[model samples]
Target: MTTLSHSPRHGPTRAVLRLHRVPLWVWTVLVIAGAGGLTWLYALGQEAASYGACGGTGMPECATEMRYWGSEHQSAKLLAWLPCGIAACAGAVLTGRELEHGTATLAWTQSVSPARWLAAKLAVPVVALLGGTTALTLMFRWVWGAGPDGGVNRWNSEYFHAAGSVGPAYVLLGLALGAPAALLTRRTLPAMGLALAGIGLAYHLGDRFRSSLWPASEVRGPWDSALNHVDQLEFGMIMESGERVSGLDCSDQAAPGDLGTCLSDHGAVDFYARIHPTSHYWPIQLVETGIALALAAAAVAAAFWVLRRRLP
Candidate 1:
C-alpha cells in the first residue's frame, strides 16, 4: 500500500506571508518608489549637466544649473531613508500585530510550533528587508555616485547611513529589534514605539561614533581653500608650536592684513582640518555596517531567548 504525504515544507512560511501581505505590498511600493526616485534624479542630473554649456566656472548658466540640481538632489535624498522606514513598519505593523492579537499563539495550536512560527515570521520579513534595502542601496549609490559630487558628500551623516551596506545593515537591525520589541511588549503600538525608539538610539550612537571608526586625514591649509572644505570633521588652526586649536574666528569681516596677525596672536601658524576624503567612504561604510550587523545579530538572539522563556 502506497501512503500519500500531504505535509508541506513551507506551510509556516506561506502562512506568515499570507498573514502579513499588507506589509509585503507596502515594501513593494517602497522599492518601486526608490527606483523611480533614482530614475528621476538621474534625469535631473542629466539636465543639470547639460546646462554646463559655458566654458568657465563662475558663469550664470552654471550657477543656475547648480541651483536646480541642488533642489532635486535634496528631494532625492529622502529616498535614501526609505529602508529604515520600511523596517520600522514591518516590525511594528506586521510582527507586533501578530503577537499583540494572539495570532502567534493561535497558529501554534494549529500544529505550527512556536519556534517554527517565529522563524517563519522573522525569515519572511528579513528576506524582504534584505532584498529591498540592497536594491535601494545599489540604486542610490549609482544615482549619487561612489563619492561626493556637487553637494552630496558620502561622509555626510545622512548620506553615510544611506549610501552603501550601512543603510541595509541599519534596516536589518531594525528588523531584528522589532521582533524582540514585539515579543517583549506583546502589543502593537507599544512594540512599534519601542522599536522606533531603539532604532533611533542606534542611529544616534552610530552617528556619534562614526568618526572614531576610521582615522581622519588632517591637512594644513588656508580655510578658504576648496579642497579642505568637503567632508571636514574638524577645522582648526595649527599653532607654530604644533598645537591644534579649534574654533578660530575667521570671518570675512576680518581686515585682510589684520587676519594674519590675529591668527599669529592666537598661536596659529596655519589653518588645519581633519577630514574624511572620498576614498574613506567605503572603509567607513564597511566598519559601520559591521557594527550594525552585530547589533542585529544580538537583537535576534535576544528575541529568540525571550520567545523561549515566555512560551512553551
Candidate 2:
C-alpha cells in the first residue's frame, strides 16, 4: 500500500498576512497616497519659489498660491504622528482581538508553539511598518528640500521626526509597546487606549529632551552678536570667571545701553548661546533612534514574558 502525505498550505507568517490582509492593504494605500501627495507638493513648492517676489505690487496671485502651499505643508506635518495610529491598531486588532476571541488559543493548538505564534504576530507587522515608514521618510526628505530657503527649519519637530531615521524608530517603538499593552490588557479597547497613552508619553519625553541628547555648541560674544542661525537650546551670561549662568533676566533695562550695564552688574562678561548646528542633525537623530530601539527591545521582551505567563 502506498501512503500520501500533504504539506500544510500556510505557515505562521503567511497566516498572519492572511488574517490581517485588510490592514496590510490599508497601509499600502496610505503609503502610496502619501508618496503621491508629496510629489504634488514638491511641484507646488517649485512653482511658488519661482514667483520672484510674493505679496508685492503686481504679484497678488503669488500671495494666494504661497498661502495655499504653506497650508498644505502644515497639514503634511501631521504625518509625523502616523505611528501613533499604528500603535492603537496593533493593540486593538492584532494581539488583543485575537486573544479576546480565543483565536490565539486555537493557533497554539494547531502545532504552533505560543512563542512562534506571538513572534509571527509581531514580526509581520514590524516588517510592514518599517517598509512603509522608510518610504514615507525618504519622500518627506525629498519634498522638504524643495522648499525655499528659510521657509522651513530642519529642526521643526514635524520635519525633524519625519525626515529621518527617528520616524521609523518611533514606529518600531509603537509596535513594541502595543504588543505588550495588548497582552497585558487582554481587551481590545482598553489595550488600544493603554497603547496610545504609552506612545504619547514616549513622544512627550523624547521631544522634551531631544536637544540634550547631543552636547550643544557654544557661541560667546556680545549679547546681540552671539546669536547664530541655528537651533538655540539655551542662552546664558558668561561671567568674567568663565562660569555660565542661565536665566539672565534683564527686563528692567529700559534702554539698549542699560542692557549692557544690567548684564555687567550681574558679572556678565559676554553672552553665550548653546545651540545645535545643522551638522548635529544626524547625530541627534541617530542617538534618539538608538534610545527608541532600546526601549522597543525591552517592550518586546516584556510581551514575550507576558505570553509565557498566560500560557498553560
Candidate 3:
C-alpha cells in the first residue's frame, strides 16, 4: 500500500498561486511598466535640469516642456491608487469568487483548513504588493530627486505617498479591507463594490486630514513675502494685539496706496501662514503610514474572526 504524506508546508500558498496566477502576472507586468515609465521620465528630468533656466543659453522651450512633463506624468497618481485595485481584486477574485462558486468550501473540506486557506489568500498578495510597491516607490523617489527642486511639490498627495512608506501601507490597507468585505458579502460583485467603497472612503478621509497629522510650521511676514516654497495650510493676518484673523477677513481690495492703512484699521499688522515645510514630509508620512497599517491590522483580524465564526 502507498503511504500518503500529511505535511502542509507551502501547500496552501502554492494552491493560491495556481488559482490567482492571472492577477499575479498582471501585477508583475504593471510594476515593470511603471518602473520603465519612471525611468524614462527620470531621463527627461535630467535633460530638463541640464538646461539651467529659461533665460539661460539652454533651450528656450525647456521650462514649458518640463512643466508639461511634470503635469502629464500620472504614474505616481496611479501608484497611489494601487490599494484600491488590490482591494477590488481581493474581494472579487481571492475570496468572493471562490466562496460564491463553492470553491472555497470545497477547499476547506480537503486537507486545507479554512484558516490556512484564508491566510494563504492574504499572505501571497501581501508579499507581492509590498515588494512591488516598494520597488516602485524607490524608483519614483529616485526620479523625483533627479528633477529640479521646483519641478513638483513634495507635499502633493500622489508624490508624497508614492515616494515614501505610505504607498505600501495603503496597498496593505486595501488588501486588509478587501478580504473582510468578501467574507461578508459572499458574492463577487457585492464584495468588490463594498471593498472599493471602503477604500475610497479611507482615501478621502486620509487626504482630507493628512496635513493635520503632524504639527505645521508657522511663518509671519508681509503679505507679499517669499513664503511660496512651503505647503501653506492656512493664511491669516497677524493682528497688532498678536491675534490672528483669517486672510479673507482682511481683504486686499483696499486702495493700493492705503493698503497698510486699511490693514491697521482692521487691527492687522502682518501676514501669517501655517505651512508644512519639506522637513515635515517624513513625519507626516510616518504618522499616516502608522494609521493605515493599524487599520489594516484591524481589518485582517476581522477577516479571520468572520471566517472562524462561519466555519463549522
- Candidate models: Cα lDDT each: 0.76, 0.79, 0.79
Better of 1 and 3 by TM-score: 3
Candidate 1 residue lDDT tens string, 15-59: 878877887887788788778877777666666666655456788
Predicted structure 1: lDDT = 0.76
For candidate 2, what is the TM-score? 0.87
On a 0 to 100 scale, what is the lDDT of residue 21 in model 1?
Answer: 87
lDDT for predicted candidate 2 compared with the true structure: 0.79
Candidate 3 lDDT by residue in tens digits, 146-250: 775554566777777778998888888888888888888888888888888888888889889998899988877554425555678988788788888875434
- C-alpha lDDT of residue 138 in model 2: 88
Q: In model 1, where do residues sit more than 4 Å from their true spots? A: 1-7, 53-76, 146-149, 224-229, 253-260
* Top model number, TM-score: 3
* TM-score to true structure, per model: 0.86, 0.87, 0.89
The alpha-carbon lDDT assigned to residue 144 of candidate 3 equals: 76
Descending-lDDT candidate ranking: 3, 2, 1
